[model samples]
Target: MQDCRILITRPEPENTLTCERLNTHGWSAVPLPMMEIFPLKDTNKKAVIRAQIFDIDTFDYVIFVSKNAARLACDWLDECWPMLPANVHWIGIGQGTTQTLLNEGVPALSNPGHTTETLLDWLKPARMRDQKILIIRGEGGRPELGNKLEERGAKVSYLSLYERKKPQYSAQTFFMLPDINLIWITSGESLLNLSEYVSLHKPEWKVLPVLTPSIRVAQQAKKMGWINASCANGADDNSMIKATEFHIGKQND
Candidate 1:
């Protein structure tokens, strides 16, 4: 793994950190953000988001679906609330998301992938029949969380703070990709964007090793015709690094 060159496809800020982490762990990391995040700008969507923020106290729990959502939730709370509601719980599905909340001085119960099952297991003993939940996320996120909450009878609502768009990489940029040994993808959308690039250009790269943050996302990559996609235990830094190491070892073997 000493010569491992990994292609990081996460969005900015996070991708910068990921590159640093990978380098620290002895991997050569290349950052080429496949997707970019942008806040909702349509007046009608903005109004809907504002209305949700205004009614924040009404929900029993507010769950952030990503690091982007958590940060935006902080911003929205700042716009209207003098103080955070005392009774409402905050949830973030991954370590990155949870850490984002912590950075904002919000103690989230759980939402990072490794911790998500713990949150659901914790709910098993509670009465969700009458609970109210608000899931804050970017556009086109998976609906499984809300669907599961509803299955338990919790009234579920969603607030989308941003949209994830494929970045416009120049044709030259695609041609200049490193001799990457591994590709790291944390989200389905990231995988989708990368697949689009591979589909249009280096079709042979489909067989290159891919490391995904979760089994669900790995499955998605496979369904999309990725020839070799590996699953990490979770999206937390340790899990990703460990999975990357596994891919490295397996390749070297």
Candidate 2:
């Protein structure tokens, strides 16, 4: 392996662990986070908390979009209500979020695909109709999941747990280095941020294959005229490694 370098564009814990996993699998992995998440200001989030305080038991299900959402929402839950309602079902978007719930001594419903569209697909036809669902998420996440829930006759309420913003451009991200073998994008927003950050630096380069988990991210990159972008079918560490191996082989030709 002639240093098949890959860059991971996910944030914080996800990026760090993803890089470690790639290294374990015999790839030179570099973490280049394009977005940073910060807990929402307490004062700003209090209103949303207050609104949901009374109707907490009215919700049939509580959904978590990310681990951060699950952690933050549970923290507040511990403070407001001594114990969770015994009958309320908990749903998580993926393995990561589901694990968070599991750690809290609950086995939550895990959606097959991590994306909102797939999550909605998994919830529809049977579970969503007449369900009172409360979505625990960050400020300004994709509205598709909530909108789909509403359209499917679910009474959906969103509980904002935190916020995320574009990370400041890292000077290290621009320094001339060997062309990357594969660039991994874990989030659609991070992919967009990576493009904007690269555009600001205006790195002189030809074309490099970019791998992302979502079609939406690939489309965004395509709009920027980045032709060598593709979506990975399986959204996991194994799938990312497989995609990287495939692209590296193509690049060698």
Number of the top TM-score candidate: 1
Q: Model 2, range 1-253, lDDT digits (tens) per residue?
A: 4487887877787788888988888888877788788877787568767568546778998888887787777777777777777778888887767887889765588878867778777866566788898888888988888888888889988888677888886666577645676688777788778888777664442166788777887788788767788987544576677788877777678
What's the TM-score of each model vs. the native? 0.91, 0.86
Tens-digit per-residue lDDT, 1-253, candidate 1: 6978988888987899989988988889999998899999999998998898999999998988788889888998989887888899887887778888999888787732453454676677778897999989898887777887899999999899999899997678878877878888888788888888889887887888888877778889999888798788666667788887777777679
Give the clashing pairs for model 2: none
Error of 1 at 7 (Å): 0.5
Q: In candidate 2, which residue ranges exceed 4 Å CA deviation? A: 50-55, 78-83, 170-173, 176-178, 202-206, 249-253
